[model samples]
Every structure is written in structure tokens, then in C-alpha cells.
Target: MTRHKLGFWILTALVVGNMVGSGIFMLPRSLSEAASPAGVILAWLATGLGVLMLALVFGSLAVRKPELSGGPQIYAKELFREGSHGSRLAGFMSTWGYWVGNIAGFVAVITTFASYLSTFFPVLTSDKVWVDTGILTLKAGNVLTFIVCSLLLWGTHAICMKGMNGAGRLNFIATATKVVGFALFIIIALFAFQKSNIGPFLAPRTNDSGETLSLLSQVNAAAVGTLWAFIGVESAMVFAARARRKQDIRRATIAGLLISIVLYVGISILTMGLLTQHQLMASQNPLVDGITAVIGPIGGKLLAALGLISLLGSTIGWVLLSAEVPFQAAKLGVFLPSFSKENGKGMPKTSLWISNAVGQVLLLSTISGSISAAFDFIIYIATLAYLVPYLIASLYHIKLIWTGETFTTRKERVTEGMIAGLAALYSLWVIIAGTADLKTFLLGIVLIVSGILFYPLLFKKGKVRGTSN
Candidate 1:
């Protein structure tokens, strides 16, 4: 019997749903704090161009190497000679980091879900401390937020366990609800928009240390936050084996990206027209706040509902994606054989559990800080983890062109070269700028480098692809 393959619409929904997650509802706050209006706008432009190149790379390679699935991390193998240790290790490490990053991405989604739900239940975002000790101080709101996040994560896991079809349908419904809801919000904002709220386009921003940031610094600061909005652009590529047509993988990626870019830009920019930068920077749910400022408190609740729906769909999509990565990598023999195990429903049960189990630990991280702070922490780590595979993939894209492996015409090679070049630089630039904070950077390094401990697991069964030993 043949497996039910995902068609363009389902594939596109998966890509869009994952990319348009919690970031959309909350990014206005992050961006406003990171940069002025001009810097934020420039950041989006730069991110859009760079991510398109990366998306194109996925599309180009998806068509050129039809057999390769599981996104650019799998393509990392080809960056080295076939059957070499470098090829196997590179692929394994890249997939490992990507998988870990994906787990954190799920945590980010659910944590933001809790944030939006806080709009209705103020306790979830409350700062009231119920217990304090020299070793630990516990806030009532943080504990409740953790509970909310964990329940949402596992509940999605349960639905996913029933089978992909059920989860896919559920995600599709949630995605549609958000698309319509946001469209309505944008229309309403247009009428209620106040131009005076936009303030100066390029006013200097002050950092937490009270230091004034230059324009370049502001753009650098906003780049990572903005790029987070597009982090899941490769969702369709990651599930390439399940695509009804290999070519649909490319189409779905580009289509999903264009869809998300429009929604993100509209929501991000239009909110500025509704609320002042200071108000936006302080808002936990900026979209809700923007809508509230426009219509009334009723608008805030409605947008909050939209955020919950959007985040619900995103959580489902990313959880599916994160599990699929390990399962696909294991099938390709780059990950542990345990992850390749599937249940009666043809789902990666083991991989799903392990991935969510790690995410459960990550959810605990929200128990001590503000919800937005926790969201930022997890997303930073995830974005860092994700950029490694992206940089590796961009380098591999360049390598293919350099060796004349995928193209025939000089024009084709030159075109692919420029795309690969820009993507590689973008990846490197974000990695540098995002890691400027030593503590978070070091924390991200520790999580990724910890993958080395499990590196030996790749060969424990002596089954890793290209393993010669």
C-alpha cells in the first residue's frame, strides 16, 4: 500500500503555519525594542531578500537532487566526498543541531501561546511571587504559565499520535482561521490607524544599558528577531519524501514564503500605525494591543483569540516538523536508529516522544521570568541552532555550483552562485549579530555542542550512512 502523500495545499499550509507562528503576534514588541521604524523596515527588507535566497536554494536543490529529503541539513552530506567520514559527520551534526533547534522552536510557540492566553487569564502572565528561597523564588504566574505551555505541547502530541492526517486537518483548520482573522484585523487597522503614532522613522534607540544605538546597530539587533518570523520556510522541504510531487516541494516553499512575508510585513508595519513605539516595546501581545488601541478592549480579546489560534496551528506544525526531522535523518542513517522506529499509524512515535520530552524541559524555563523573556530566550537558542544548518547549506550550495555539479550553463552557475553567496553572508551576519550577547551566545553554544556527546550514537549500531569503520 502506498502512503498518503501531502499535496501542495497541505504542504503549503504546513510551511506557512510553522513560519507564521508566535513570532507574528509578539514580534512587534521585539522589533520595536530592537530598532527604530527605519531600522526595522530595513531589517525586514534584508531578511526577506536573504531568506528568499535560502528558499531558492532549497527549491533548486530539491529539484536537482530529487532523492535528497529532510531539508538542507541532508544536503550537508554532499558538501564532502561521498562515502567519507566528513560527509557522515557533517550530515549527522547538522541534523542533530537542526533537530534540537526544532524542539526549542516548539517550546517558543507554546510559551507564546501561554502569553496570548494571558490576555483572558491574567494569572498566566502575573508576577505575583508565591514562594521565595535563597536558592529559588517561584512566581505564581510563571508556574501557571508552565502548566499551560506543557499541557498545550502534550495535547498536540496526543493529537499527532492519532496520525498525521488528523493533525494535518486540525492544523489546516487553525491556519485558515488565523488567515481570515488577521485579514480582518488588517482591514480594521487601516481605518483606525493613527499616523502620529509612527514617530521618527530613524530615531536612535537606547539599549538596556542606556547606551544609544547607531542605525547599523539597530538593524543588527532587529535582524535576528525579524528573521525569526521566517525561520520555518523549509518546512515543505523537510518533508519532501511525503510531497505528492518533488517539484511541489519547491513551489510550496516559495508560495508559503511569499504568503508569510506579506502577512508579517502587513501586521508588523500596520501595528506601528496603530500604536506608538514606546507602547509597542512594552506590550507583551503587541498585535492585541495594537488592535485594542484601534477598536477597543473587545478588539484586544479578538486578536488574542487569533493569536491563540495561530499559535495552536504553529505548535502542531512545528511539533510534526521537529519529529519528522529526526525520523527522516534516522532513515537516512545519520541519526540514531531508535528515532526511526514507527508506530502502527506510520508515525515516528519514539522520535515524537523524545522531541516533546526535551521541549517539556524547555517549558520549565518559563517558570522564573516574564513570558516574553522566556520566549526570546528559547527563540534565540533555536535561531542560533537553526543558522548552523543554514550556513552549512549555503556553503554546500556554493560548493555545488563551484564543482559544476547541478547546472549546465554558465548563466545558471552564475545565478546560483549569487544566490548562494548572498544566503551564506546573511547566515554569517545573523550568527555574528545574534550572538553579540555573550551569555545567550554561550548558552546556545552549550546546547549545540552538547550534541557531540550523542555523536557516538550515530555509529553505535554501525549503521550510519557512509560509515566505513
Candidate 2:
């Protein structure tokens, strides 16, 4: 098992690949509805700085506490008093939220994949109904899309079950391909760029209800969508146990963040030069439209194919990540001990089944709506679940600095403090100000609070070691 460890590039690919998934392909349309060009710019800038700080904190902790193998769960749990209830609860709840968040990410990518596949088969998104009764109605297109998403989920699960090395190699190739593809599009968009398409850069965008949103409201509206693009920033830390070198985790994290930020900013902002806000907003696959405008119809087909490939690879990476959280947490005594089981190939068989099962349920929920609407709904819950762990990890980093636990160097202390401070503030800001709706936010809270029912299960068998978990 030790011989199959991941090197720096693969680790970096996980960070990059998981992040540059379906989010970027559909970003133009998502941002078009939420913000003007200026607001979009501000949202990315804020999210970039905030997530970078988080990457730094994760990297710093990897070096400072190599024993922390899992992501925020172990960090939040082990950083405090050993054998105490507080730390125990911290690890359990963090794992619960992050694990569920990972599942949401998996569903989001697969749903988008089906949406892009509609380029080849338009029926996938058609609202025409195939089956209906007085008691129930099922749109054939939605049913087909749901079937496509479920197949993708289980197919990716099968690949991961073979082991990480094979899945990682496939993901790395797809990541590289998408990066080149986006870079090519960015270059093409540059030559064909038009200032008028961008409209008034600072203009206030009107909401669908015919109400105009101010600049601040626009920024708030768009910030969460941008932040969602960078959701996999902690991929390296989550898989730290499989990383060949401790320092490589830090390098992979920072390198991945820089590359993804460039792609996200370029593809989103430059695409504005290719299509007007109204055109982009109406597009189901905005990148395809952007490319089609620049080069012709062939470009749309090529971009759609690329979107499928990108999301396919993203599914593999996120499945591995989501499964690992509970597997690692279980071994550390923070989750149910049964989750720690592994197959002959060193894959977490038990965790994979449970995680993907939850993902299946999420996919099933989308049958009542259009695939596009499902994407938005799933992303909201996923984003909200992800925010809590990020907040916990950031605050914990600051606490370590203040208490001089992670390191004692005074110069390093100030730098870490500043980074973690900004990260914590940004996490809080996104939750409080950038949320799309209050009901969805409360729904996420209910999901996290729901973990309490299972908390007592960990201690029933007395398997958790050295702490409260």
C-alpha cells in the first residue's frame, strides 16, 4: 500500500481537477444572472484571497502537524484538548458536514455532465413528459437525465474501487486536457474581444422580478457562486495520508490554487466579451455559446465534449475525496468504526458505498425539476455544508497561533495570524451575506444538526481512541 502513494503532480492535479469541474463550464450563465461585470470581478477577487488564505492555513498545518491526516475534521478534533467532549464533537460534526458537502459536489458535477450530454441528445433536457398519473408525474427528459447521473455516479464508484492510482491517472489526464482547452479558448476570446459585449461594467443588474439590485447586493449575490468554484482547495489535505511527502501537500495546494484561479477568472470574465449578458444568461451551456460566437458552430460541439470529459474526471476525484473523509475519520475514532474498513486494494469499500448511496438520493431528488434547476439547488446545500468546516478550520488556525501551539517563531506567527484572520472573516461573510436564501441556509443547518443522532454510536463500542470522539 505504501508503494502506491501519490506524488506532487497527482496531488496538485486532485486539487486542480476537483476544482475546475462543471462549475467553470457553467459559470458564465450563473454569474450573468447574479452580477454585472464589475460585481463579478469583485466576487472572484474576494473568493480568491479568501480561499488562498485557507490553502495557506491547510499547508501550514500539514507541516506543523503531520499527524493530522484527514482534512478539517481531524484538525478541528485533534487540535483541542485530548479525550474531551468538545474536541470529540468538533471532529464528528466537521466530518459529517464535510462528508455530506463532498457528496453534494459529486452530484453537482454529474448533473452538469448530463446537461452537457444534452448537446449530443437534446431530449435529456426536454420538458416533455413520458409518464403521468393522477398521483404522480414524471418528465421523460428529467428521468433520463436522472438515470444518466446515477449511472455516472456508480460508474465512477467502480473505477475508484479499483484503487486510487488508476483513478488518479485518469483524472490527471482529463485535468490537463481541460486546462489546455480553457487556455486555448481564453486566447481565442482575446483576439475577438469586444468592449461593448461587456456592457456597462459597473451597471446594476436587475433581478428576474424586475427589481434592480444595487452594487453591494450584486456582489453579495455573486460571491457564493464564485467561492463554489474553488471548493476543492483542500483536496491535498484531505488525502494527506496518501501523499508521498508532507511538504508536497503544501506545494500541490498552492500550485493548484494559482492555476485554477487563473482559469476561473479568465474563462468567466473573458467570455463576457464574447456574448451579451442576456445571451449568456439564456444559454444552457454558456462556454459552448462563448466558443461558438468566437469561432463558429464547431466550437460549440468541441466545448460540449470538453465539458463532459471535465465533469467525468471531476466525478472520480470527488468520489475519492468524499469517501476518504469518513474512512479517515473512522480510523481516527471520530466516526463509526465500520467506515474504516478497506478492501484488498486499500480503497475504503464501506465508506464508498455509504457516500455514493447518499449521492444517489440527492440525484433522485432532482427528478421533479429541470436538470439546470437541480444543479442550482444541490449547489446551495453543498455550499452551505462546506462553509461550516471552512469556518472551523480557519478559526482553529488562529487559535493555534494565539496559543503558540503549532509553531513558536514570532515572525511566522504574525503572517499566519493575518492569513487565518482574513480566512475566518471571509468564511463568515459568505455564510451571513452571500447566501442565496435563508430557507436553504436553514436547511443546511438542519443537515449538520442532524448528525447528533449518530454521535452516540461512536462511543457505543468504545472504538474511538485518545479523545472525545
Candidate 3:
């Protein structure tokens, strides 16, 4: 099969689309409860910087080894395979992490879409709505969740099935709409903010021990929770081989990342400034709340619709990248050979179908829960898997610099490598900070075990030769 024919616009969309998803629509309120408005802004800024660094590192690696198949996985495998001291197991784990992170990204978008719909329609947000039998007590806003999420999934698939051209066009519109939506949200919130709502910007409250604690802790928590907004900065690196110009990969990723940073930080600050900690914490969809408060009901609904579209775009782009990761890995002999198969559409049919199938399964299982709860669970587990690759990629950067092997411009190389190293450390820190429940952690272990068990099955029938598409 020929490699996917994505150009600069599609590549940029992938970066922007992947980074902008559900997080922008819902993260602000959750973050406001944890920290002050300033904390939320700082969190956005920090996450943006860390993730941008990741993109730069990945871009540098892609430029250096333009022919590699897997993203961070390829970099790690090459580092260890070419006589470096790194472990082959580390390379293997990195591949698994990247794959799992994409799955989490899927879950995040779907849940956020569901959360937004719940606002317009309300029964979907409650756990009891689904359990009470035949009461016909249709919650006013709940049905919208399932409807919107289904539409998003199918609509994205429809465009994607048309090939990369359709997806590229959709991505352009979706990315622009997403950024504008957030910008409008911020502008409205600022104009409508009430001085009363800004009360006690840093209030001191009594703790359980009758001691006072600063109100900013909540904002700190909010910042940490909202940090995942920047997680998809590596979107360009995954499909680097498909870009119009090899070097354009760095420019596209960096530009897209910076764009999202502006959107995320601006909206987050406005949201916190307009709503009290109690109001922000209690909000189901903070961005929507801020918009509704600033504009009118009509504006809120329009924003929700835009948010839904943005979520769909992110899902489509994420699914494409997620499916490609395994397919590319399989072609490189890092996964089962069956995954390398492609259909007449030039799609990695088997891989794409399997990835979609798994994502659907996740959606069905978690749709009944609180959107934020479901998101964190998926993200925490996925982060565990995704972090391994970041670390390996960062270490690879250090190795290259130490060996004095040139990749891109010397300035670019040094900057990319340093950023990669910092981002890697930050990724590890985030993973440690995430509080994954027992079920998710166990599920992760089971998946890892299954991967290890199936390793030899994929390698059977003699040595696998490198297959170039």
C-alpha cells in the first residue's frame, strides 16, 4: 500500500485537531475549583510548553530519520537496535504506551462530547437515569449525549472514508471553528465577569485541623487536572513521512501547538475570572457555562455545537494516527504481521477496523459515568503507556547529542533535544501524579501481559524482513 497522502494543511490540522479536542470544552471549570484563575492559566502555559517540547523533539527525530515507521517507538527501537545501551524492552514498552495513549485520547473526546450534550438535554449526567427501569423519566437533556457522540463518530468516519483529502478539509474547518469558539468564549466571559464573583481571589479557609489553608490549592489541582489539554502535540510526528516536505514537520507541529496554547490559556483565564470557585467546581461544562453566562442561551448552544464538531474532528484524526501506529509497527515487525494489511482504499483496513472497534467498546462501557470521571480514568491509564515512549525518545536525543551525530540545524537539534528531555521528565511526573483507580491499573497490567504473551506469535514463521510501503 502507498503511504497516506497527507499534505501541510492536513498535517497542521492533525496537530491542531488532536490538541484542541474535548479538553478545551470542559477542563476550565474542573481546574478553577483546584486553583485560582492565575493557577489555571499557569497550568495551561506549563502544559503547553511541555507538550510543545515533545513535538519539537519528535520533529527533530523525524527529520533525522525520515524513513522510520513507528513514531517514538521507532526512535527508541533504533536507538537500542543500533548498539546503544538502552533496553529493547524499553523500545517495546514505548510502542505500547503510544498506542494506549491514542485510545485514551479517543475516550477523552467521546466523553467530552457526551458532557456537552448533557447540558442541552440533563438526564445523561446522572448514574440513576439509566438504572431506573421503564420509569420513562426521560431526563430533559440526557438523550443528547448518546445522540451527539454517535453522530460525531459516524460523521468523522464518513469523511475519513472519503480519504485523506476529505479529512484534511474537515480538519481545516474544525480547527478554525474550535479556535474561534474558544476565543469568543474568553471575550464574552471577560465582559460579563461580575466583581462579586471574583471575591476572595485567594481566600483562606479552615482545614480539618482548624488551620487555615490558601484557596489556591484548588486551582493547583485544577491546573494539574487540565494539564492533559496539551498532550497531543506529537500529532505531526506520527505522520511525518506523509507530509509534503520532510522539514515542514517541525514548523507545522510547533505552529499548531502554539496556536492551541493561546486558545487554551486565554479561555482558561477568562473562565476562572468570571466564575467563583464554587460555581466553577460545580459546573459540568465550564466553557459552556462561561459562554452562556457571557452571551445568551443561543450563544451557548452554538458553542456546544462547535465543541461537538471539534471533538469529532479530533476523534477522526486521533483514530487515523492511532490505527497507523500499530500498522506501521507491524510493518516494521514490532507488531503482528496481520496489521500491515491494507484495503483498496489505501487504508490499513485491518488496523483501522480493530482500533475503531476497541474505541467503540470503550465508549459504550463508560458512557454511563460522569464525563470527567471517565476521562481521568482513561487518561491516567493511557498516560502510563504513553510516558515510556517519551522517556525513550528523550534519552535517544541525549545519545545523539553525545555522539556528535548531526540531525537538523545545530540550533534546532540542541533545542529539540533539551526540550525532549524536559518533556520526558514532565511526562513521568504527570504519570506519577495521576491517581488511577485499581480497575484501570489492573486493566493496564492485563493488556501489558497480553502484549508480552503475543510477542512470539507475531514473530513466528521465520525472521520478518523489513517491509517498505
Candidate 4:
């Protein structure tokens, strides 16, 4: 691949864009219903801490060896090269699992963009009165949804085909839109807040009604929801090779995470202040909806339209990032060689197509549902995909530090390693608690088994692509 001078800021922008997408715009209303307003705040705090730790872990590893590629794959290969074939297989499975998760995530984000678009144009969201079908029915919205999704998917595909520079420039713009949009939301909502809505805000509520016999358990569930909001925290880590400066990695990681936390907590407080619990819970797009209510119909629609742009920007970043995953893994010799190809412009041609294909499959599967449900399902899947790599990368850092590996001299190895190790542990806790569902658990298992089976076929070809230093 041709080396592009993609700076830390552009990379940071992608991280910001990916992290601040459809979730914050929509997840809060559902989260409010699941937990008390107080519980939601706690969730933000805990998830923020968890993400910070994970960032510290990756930061330490990046500092130690800037030569590594494929964030989790690099960590696994570095840690387990001395292990058996089965151990190696586990690493490969983990790498591919991460790829699957991100691809699913891309589809989810695009589907979400489609939903937000429907909000402004009801014609795009309305159901088809004519297609009275069986278990599966198509709507006019579905038609628009598919068309919009396909176009976005293909558009990103072409961008990736052009190379990292194109992707980076667009990511920068998207990231800026995201930051501005959130900031604008927070500022407007803060001044617009009514005193009545702000009172009794700490209404100690619960995340689930399944007899959570303890206060801590309830707190833990709220944390899980908050952690879900931070799902894209390590997004920039995957593109470690693309970072311009070594310190930039650490700086971007910390800055992006801190910004996301502030916005999350601030928005929550502002929204709660401006809207009654009843109003907030009742709203589908509470942040935007609240903004609209305050600003008027024109303002509401304008914010919603900005939201559509923000969502598209986010989806684009993820699609580019997701497309790079398998290609990165392939380059690192963790996946098949085909994924490692680059066009004349140094774009990961084959891998981009593969990512697009997977996203398309996910899009079609959920296209029949209401735009919201379809988008939610996609994001949920993407979150799981993101979690696996985070777990591996964090664990690898922890294992190295615990074992006292002498790979770095710039910082205290043991201190950094232990911090990273703990981050991994926290991430696992969050994943288990946050993604507790029969389907999600089953999907995780399926990804693991499938990766184990498929990687060996690629290995047998003896053309595996190794990582670029």
C-alpha cells in the first residue's frame, strides 16, 4: 500500500466520527426507560473510565512497538507466537471475529443514517400500503432505505478505492460535523432547560426488572448501557499504521475519549433539564427532538437534517474503517492473502469489496423491518464486533505487563501493562453485561467457530500477507 501522510487529527476525526454516531442520537431514550436518570449518569461514568483504561492500554502498546499492525492481531501475534497451533488459531479467530463485527457495524450505521433521513422526509419512512405480504413485508421506506444504503455503501467503497487520503479528508469533515452538532445540541439544551425537568433528576431507577436483587448489580447494568455508547472508543487504534506521530496516537486516544464523555454527560444533563422524564422517555430522538421543540419546526427540521449529515459522516468513517480491517489482518498475516491486496493507488481493493459485500448482506436481511429496528440490529451487531478486538488487545497488553516483557524502555513497562490488563478485564465485564442476549451470545459463538474453520483454508495457500512495519 502507498504510504499516505494521514495525520493524527484526521485519524482522531475518524475516531470521533465513529464513536458519536446514531447511538447518542437515539440510544438515550431507550436507556432512560431501562434505567433511572441517575443510573444513566452512572453508566456514563463507568463506561468512560473503562474506555480510558482501554485507551491507556493501547497507548502503552503503541509506544512500545510502533511497528505492529492490526491492533488486536498485532497484540495476539506478539504475545502468542510461542504457543501451539490451537493458540494461533484462537488469535486468527479473534482477528476475523473483529472483522465480522465491524462489517456488521458498517451496515448498522448506514441503516441508521437511512432512518434519520426518513425523519425529515416521511414519505421515505412510511409503510407500503400496497405490499400486503406474508411474514415479511416491504414498505416504501424499505425501498428508499435500501436505495439510500446501497448508495452510501458504494460511495464509501469508491472512496476507499481512491486511497486513505480521500477517506481521511472526508473523515475529518464528518468528525467536525459530529463535534459541532453535539456541542450545538449541548449549548442550546443547557439554556433552554426548565427548572421542573431538572428536579428529582436523580430518580434512582433500575436497568432491568428481572429482580436485580442488589444496588451494585443495577449500577453495573447502567454502566453497561453507557459502555455501549462508547463502543467505538478504540476505532483509531485499528489504523495504527496510518498515524503520523507516535505521541499523536496517545493524544488522539485520550482527547477523543474525553470529548465523547463530556458530550455524553453534558447532553444527558441538558436533555433532562430541558425535557421531563416523561418527555425524554417518550421521545425517539430526544436530543434532536428537544432541540426542535426549543428551536421551533424550522430549527427542529434543520437539526434533524444536520443529524442526517452527522449520521452519514459517521457511517462513512466506519465503512472505510471496517473495509480496512480484513485487509489489515491480511497484511499482518493473520487472515487470507486475498484481503491484503492493494490497487495502483495503494487502496485495499479486495478487502474493501469484501467489507461492502458483508454490509450489503446485513442490509438486505434487516431492510424489511422498520428503519429504526433495522438500524438498531445493525449497530448491536457492530458493537459486538468492536468488543472482541478491544478484549484481545487489552488482554495482550495486560499479559505482557504481568509477565514483565522487556519490550519498551521509554515508560515503566509493568505500570503500563497492568493498566492495560485491568482495562481488558473491565472491557470483558462490560461486554458480558451490556450484550447479554441469547441471539448476541449465539452470534459471538458462531463468529468464533466460523473464523477457526476458515482461517486454516487461507493458511494452506502459503501466500499469507505479513504486516507492514
Q: After best superposition, candidate 2 residue 444: deviation in angstroms? A: 1.5
Model 1 collision count? 0
Candidate 1 lDDT, 1-469, residue by residue in tens: 1134688888889989999998998898889888999999999999999999999988888788767777678877777777687877787888888999999898889989998899999988677889999788899899998888889999999988888777887888888888888888878888888888989988889878899999999999999999899999999888887778988999999999998998999889999999888898888889988888777999899889888988999999999999999888888777788998888888889999999999998888898888889888888888989898888878988988998986889999999999999999999999999999898799888977788898898888576664221
lDDT tens digits by residue: candidate 3, 132-193? 44744433234445556666666666566656556667777878788787777767776876
Model 2 worst lDDT window (10 residues): 460-469
Clashes of each: 0, 1, 12, 2
Q: What local distance difference test score does each model get?
A: 0.87, 0.87, 0.68, 0.71
User: How well does each candidate superpose onto the true structure, as a TM-score?
Assistant: 0.96, 0.96, 0.85, 0.91
Clashing pairs in 2: 83-467
Off by over 4 Å in 4: 82-84, 198-217, 406-411, 465-469
RMSD of each: 1.9, 1.8, 4.0, 2.7
Evaluate residue 160 in candidate 3 and report its C-alpha lDDT on the 0 to 100 scale: 60
Can you write out model 4's per-residue Cα lDDT over 1-469, one digit (the tens) per residue? 5454667787678777877777777676656665666666676777777788888877767776676655554566656654345545655777777788777767767776776676677777666654666876777777777888899889878877887887778778877877887788888887887878744645555433445323455555566456656766666677777777777777777788888887777876677776777888777567667776788777777777877777777877787777677777666666677887888988778888887887788789545677556655555555666676788788777666667664646367766766776787887886786567667567667765677667666667566444343
Name the lDDT value of residue 44 in candidate 3.
Answer: 62
